[model samples]
Target: MSPNYKFQGWMGLDKDAAKGKMVWQEYTPKPFEETDIDIQITHCGICGSDLHVLRSGWSASLYPVCVGHEIVGVAVRVGSKAEGGIRVGDRVGVGAQSSSCLKPDCEQCSGGAENYCQNHQTGTYSSKYPDGSKSYGGYADYWRGPSHFVFKIPDALPSDVAAPMLCAGITAFSPLKRLGAGPGKRVGIVGVGGLGHFGILAAKALEVDKLVALSRTSSKKADALEMGATDFIATDEDEDWAAKHANSLDIIICTVDSPKMPLAKYLRLLRVGGTFVQVGAPEDRLPPFNILPLLAKDLKIAGSSVGSPAEIREMLDLFAKKGVHTWNNNVPLKDANKAILDMDAGKARYRFVLVNEKHVSQVERNEARENKL
Candidate 1:
């Protein structure tokens, strides 16, 4: 394999790319180093971040971006100095991150908190590397990056289900695990969408005394219960729902990214000394938060991002052993444009995964397309 392989994928040339205007064109990946690995992408989960980058919603995005992070594939080439014990042909996964400063003096790296690395943090896409090359994402046939961020997917977990877990699942799982959501603890998951569903499953896996699923309407009540939630709270349909469940939960993980969420009411649902962690990223400022409720009850409001690679490994192991699954709607890689629009319109049952069936069908098909010809 050569470093000059023709990389091709759906590239967003400008902000209008968010409206399904991406162009499928051949491009070039960053020059590889001994610490890198090339993956033949089999599945890439569509995330809200993809849309954000395409439209520069979060910040000025690097144009011509290939937006996707939740990636799963088989390693096609492993660099001699690649970290993480990765070898050629190993099935691995990459999430939102591609690199972080691993220097010994870095607080986050040395403290096992790479997610919060302050010195240097490179996203899987829409960022620049130290060498002045732009980072691409998994929306392509292949992905190349440092092996330290790649993780081995457990065999028991299917690739499709495991793809979304790379981002959405870890985003929710980290907070639940951090907030002491285990046996004897009553937990509530706000919103019944992708991240919330994972919160419900993780809480159940942690053996929480009770798990309550909260949503605006009763439409997802049955689904939530099936996902291992011990109870359901329909905020819009049930009168005094907040008061009814007030001081009932020991920990609450809010997964709704909408800015208009009932912040005060959600806080009321927390028990004394209970914690409320927001894992969802809202585009707008959160609704006016009140300090009264927080001070009166000693409630804690915190935020979390996607977990570190170590945390992802732990989550995958637990999912494989406990049979954790995601309710996903699969689409072909060619339909990513349609999939993104559908996802923005809330058409997914829970999550969406783009499968590169054409690339994964045969070893010859994969091997014939080398990154370096």
Candidate 2:
């Protein structure tokens, strides 16, 4: 028998709601199916994407959307058709994606790059399923979605820290793992905040030859170096920063979401045949750039989204095995408005995870402690 629970949460009714005006109200969730699972959310990470979609900064969003994609919770109900062998009462998580076209004929899905599924790709928030039903996100008391996108949280990972890995961590990890950032590779992570922090950790776990952290100022130099970055570049501190670091990196993961970012200068830091990845989502269009750098160095510029379920599982195992830790701040669910405001004001030390107090316990909070890598 199905358990009865209220599908309610903080919902954004209009563009102005992004300013910490989200209202707590009951909302309709997608119709449940045999292939779906119900998670009683315990922790949800507040991401920049939530703020963007709340204000319709990316594109027009469906009103009353509850946005938080990095989710961690207990599986209260599991469908027999679920793909991951999930069971009730199991700790699990879901990322920015909820559903995708998983047909074998689809090249991207079949090729193990399901994150790039071109057909019927549904975001966890502000998106509609194939049946036209609204797919809500983790900012609610409960979440119902395709189990194929759900992943079992490793026992060694604390829910508070594991929550952010679903999105921010995977968004950074997917690119580095896919681009071969290890051993002989010299990698640079731009912006030492949410996504970039995880980028540095993942690269270090992969054992890169050199890890460089690029930021606007030297404020985060100590933190970045402690997070496995061997060198730190304060761009605003050095007017000749570009020339100083030219042709030094084989791979650069640019995580800043500004149109005015020094894109050309960043490209110059890449060695010949290097790859530059832009994982940040910007509200406005990026500035136009010269093609000379690309033409001269044979550089490759690409964009990466969150990882697939397989990749998510792989990341969890790697983090657990390496004893890696994320610098995270915990905010109660009721204080979501304040949390989002602080997040917008750039006050989060690294990442913010909303804790549903009624659902969390001391055991989960003190699950395991790893080195702050």
Candidate 3:
């Protein structure tokens, strides 16, 4: 049966949309297929990538885009060909990735590295389907995408709390779990913002011996410590911060989005043969730095995007078991403009999840519009 409700959400018409200029209205979603599942979204976490897409920072975004990838809601519709054992009434989630070429010959997908799928990987929003249909995001009351990317949320985790983990949580969790961040390891998380906070939580949950939160200043020292950090470092405030913590960590997860920060200094925090994984992306190209630390200390610098679906599932169970509370607040979907402006101003204590409080029929929506007029 077709949905009785219409698809409607906030849309950014131009580059100025990032400046709180998005308009609320109805928009077309991708056509449904047997492998697709429709979600009546209850919560969507606002990510830094949302702002980048809204302002065309990453690249020129297709106009009238809806930008949110950390999605959580109930499965209102499930296609017959859909996988993941999802049912219409099941609570579920979708991350940054919506589709990947799952050909048997596709080494990335077959090898469980779908995030690095070289063929036909589609983003949840601001991307195109293989059929050339425009893909939208979760900044709406409903979301429709391929079932391969939809995951069932664990019964123990709340939807609001589980939302960010799909994206930010996995982004941090993957490198740590993959690179061995647990017991006997001394882990360092760079930047205590959205992604960094999750990194600290994940590393702590993984039972790292020493979990240090590195940032530019002491403003977030109290917050980081409360998030299970064993120590905190203000790189800019302490003159000898780099030397003070030199060769102390076994692995470092860099989550700061800006490249202008201290790259060379961060590399110095790593011990001999340590691995540094950068999970954040800077808007502009990164500046040059000396490779002296890499040569002399045998340090390795790497990068990571969002994680694969399997990694996301693992992260969910870990967070649920550990009772990891994401430091965040909620905003009504109607005030998305103000929310975007506030997010740009760095006002979020940690992260913001947009709440879709109503899923009314079109007639009811029209009646409410008339009443407002």
Please say which candidate is ahead in TM-score: 2 or 3.
2
Ranking by TM-score: 2, 1, 3
Per-residue lDDT for 257-276 in model 3, tens only?
A: 67587888888889999998
Backbone clashes counted, model 2 = 0
Candidate 1 local distance difference test against the native:
0.88
Order the candidate numbers by lDDT, best to worst: 2, 3, 1
lDDT string, candidate 1, 170-250, tens digits: 998888877777899999999998788889988988889999999999999999999999999888887789888788999
Query: All candidates' TM-scores?
Result: 0.95, 0.96, 0.95
What TM-score would candidate 2 get against the native? 0.96
Per candidate, the number of residue pairs that clash is 2, 0, 0
Q: List the residue pairs that clash in candidate 1.
A: 2-372, 5-371
Ten contiguous residues with the weakest lDDT in model 1: 363-372
Q: Please report the TM-score between candidate 1 and the true structure.
A: 0.95
- Which is the leading candidate under TM-score? 2
Q: What value of lDDT does candidate 2 attain over all alpha carbons?
A: 0.92
